[model samples]
Target: MAFDPDAKLSDVLAGGYDLNNRLQALLISRPLDSRGQEAAMAFSQELSRVFMLSLSMLNSNAVAPEVRSGNSSGVSAPAKDKRARSDNGEVVTPSKKSREEGVTRKEITPSPHKDGYQWRKYGQKKIQNCSFSRYYFKCNRHRRCEAKKKVQQQDGGRGRLPPMFKVTYVNEHTCHELRAHDDAAARMASPWTASRHHALDGVVDTARGGGGLFDLLPHIVGGGSAEENEAMVSCLAAVVSGSVPSPPPRSSGWPAAPEASASDPAASFVPPAAAGRSASVADDGAMMMVDDTGVSWDPWWSFCPVEEAAGHQLVTNQNHHRDMHMDDAGGFADAVWPEHACGAWRRA
Candidate 1:
């Protein structure tokens, strides 16, 4: 079926506006890709403009003042110096200045128009006898682009009630900043672009299954508590320090430290001590304590950044009977705290 172009088209224009509003709402409501959102916003803006232009042409007020005056006086005015005089006598195109791109007035709905361009609101004033106030705006996204608009709430229009407005634009936009902003938005959202670089790994981790944006929803949406956050941090720290086994072996270049058995605490850590002086004060102003037990543990082992010692495991050994062991060097090996070695060190 086709609409009769010659028939009265108010119903058609009204239906188009209804569709435009729905399209705008759909674009804003969904969790689509940012690039798609950008395109949707552009499409909505253009469609709205088309509808506005159509409505303007159908309105009686859009007729030229010269023609209105000529008809009233029964004499046609000369097209000499008046703005936008056409070569033919039928239509006139008005220009305020060489730089101005004429004027455009369109009825728009869903208050605080989201026409996809940023504007700086400069002024607002109530017209002398009118109840509604007019707002002036300038789109100053770029230093060279000087586009401006004036908006006032429409008084009892034929469409949606209360929030509709007549937006008048004095110049066209020259700033290509909309495209730039769209690109920047898309870049920020790049993580959700594809499985190749999903949000979970910054690039996908197929070995464990594609853990994209969903893997982070709990953390991102703040469902986890503060303790959970701390636990996560501790877990990562333990992995880095070889205290706990690392997460499933990733393609990430850093190899996972060997998981050491904590059940055999005796074989895990044995610190017989270095052949240096007894448990006296160290030259670094650190005081040491010797438990009656032969096994000594370093409190720092749980979080130390020793790449070479990644093979070492966190030995939370509570056994006081185990004998100390030494590294390849005669010095005792540095391992973590046992269950009872809490008071081993005093701050120097």
Candidate 2:
């Protein structure tokens, strides 16, 4: 079979148009359930459509000789309705290079700094009716590159919503040195990707009425039953009120300081004073101990039993017999202790 160039080009163009339509359909359906995928597909479809249209225009005999010959003077002829005109009524021949390189406008949400392209601020101007100023930036990658963009902040009256930025790109990027770096940075800075929280087993609860410190307390405490949690809360309440009870005496056979590992379940029941540290319980039942310099240590994995005599001595030294009451103003300074001293009892 003899090959025909015209027939081959026509077939390729038709196939390209068909593929573009199929991609458009896929984007409309949103099979991947991702806006990034849809945007990429839409851009690709548009590029394909433009390429096919340009090829079709080139193949036509109706194309003016001036346009085919790349003559700027003849390109402004009355035959081409698409040609723009200057203020002086002279026919303006639009930049052929810019026409070939399509322009795209993207509305970036939250911020414009994540566009991944290095832009140099050229100018700024205030627009009518808008509270924010419009900033003009030009691509600094190449001196000849004509790419420019205008960035303007979208006004959010009450700040109840995130601010938006309108970025109008005039020309295409021709720099290749930092293209990959910018793409990676944009992906990293994407709100969708950055907003994802790490999933931990039994740590986060998305269900209704599952908020607050109580939901997270169980996981932080290394898992405990309802009864154990209640008991822990009661113990914490006593500690906060300066009324902690003395632990029962251990047998003489037991070591002077019992070396209990953090993994030991019984270690959670121990008081921090037994480990030679000043202990305090937070409102949410988290136990914390302060060092000499007032640095609080996490109480979750630091429980250890103190000798009965030592525990009683430590409690007697720290506890003050004062009436504790919750104030209406929520100030704890007058409630049996100074506000600053209750560091261990405050919410993190």
Candidate 3:
């Protein structure tokens, strides 16, 4: 069969347009890995170069002479017609030339190039004082494709860092299979798959609306009375709001001590002889506790220190009267009431 140049060029142009549309769709809709994304971008850039070259060829062959003659005619035609022709021809030529120049500059500039495409290794050469060999590769997608590249490592940079590779391209690719392969690889390595796996690990079953804080609290705090749970929640709310709830009146037969203002540092201080006694404070910044034993407790831990007046606001609205107990050994231990309640209270 005889080859027709026009027919072949038309076919190539049609195929390029179709491929460009498909690439744009994939870029928008499909998730891609880093390598695949790089390949897609590089392929897009190459396609743009081809489109620009075609435009330049068409403009030069079809529009240049007519424009030049009109400009040389020296006002022979109407001003509007000449202006319109000049706008179409003269303005476009310089812009196209500048764009082509920019693309050429980018191609020659030395930089790290890792446009993902399958390349077959063809040769390796060792350079003087270099720790690595330079590897040469050719595009293997088509036998006719002349695209080739050389990758070489920069000397003297090493440990814990990525080795610098200088890549040089010799020709453009004729094979179009690189874009399809890149799209496939990108789909396979989509980040959504990893995120879905993570979501499945500890994600609450929120579809049923049952994973609320109150629902989870029973499992976390163990078994407890309803009253104790209510108290625990209220105390937690107060603590979270940066307020300390006042202790109930001393109804457990413990003796009361002298009252003092919260501003005074001496109010929270316990003498070495009187550490075993329980301490309390009045509503108006007064400390009232009587020391019963000589065993001294760290006053800072025993009571909400009077010095922390900003945090120790009395919760007068709370009607629940629960007794507070301090262990003989000075650490928080079992309460005279519910043991589970004490545990919950401590946790709050």
The per-prediction CA RMSD against the true structure, in angstroms, equals 31.8, 30.5, 36.4
Ranking by lDDT: 2, 1, 3
Q: Candidate 2 — what's its lDDT?
A: 0.41
Q: Please say which candidate is ahead in TM-score: 1 or 2.
A: 1
Q: Which runs in model 1 stand beyond 4 Å of their true positions?
A: 1-101, 157-160, 177-348
For each candidate in the order shown, give its overall lDDT on alpha carbons: 0.39, 0.41, 0.36
Better of 1 and 3 by TM-score: 1
Q: How close is candidate 2 to the true structure, as a TM-score?
A: 0.24
Best by TM-score: 1
lDDT of 2 by residue, 60-143 (tens): 635323223322121222344656443246887768765775434344333343343345556767777675567676665444
lDDT of 1 by residue, 1-348 (tens): 234555444454544545455554555456768887776777566676656555554563454453233322222345465554332464554544733655533334323233323455567666665445676766544445567666665444322222334555666666555434544567677745533322322222221223543345334422222222333555567877879532333124211111111111111122212111123332332333343344333322322222112223224343432443322110112232122111212223
Which residue pairs in model 1 clash with each other? 84-93, 270-325, 271-325
Error of 2 at 321 (Å): 51
On residues 45-95, what C-alpha lDDT tens digit does candidate 3 reach at each position?
Answer: 767655655555544545333323322112223333322223225533335
Displacement of the residue 168 alpha carbon in candidate 2, Å: 0.7
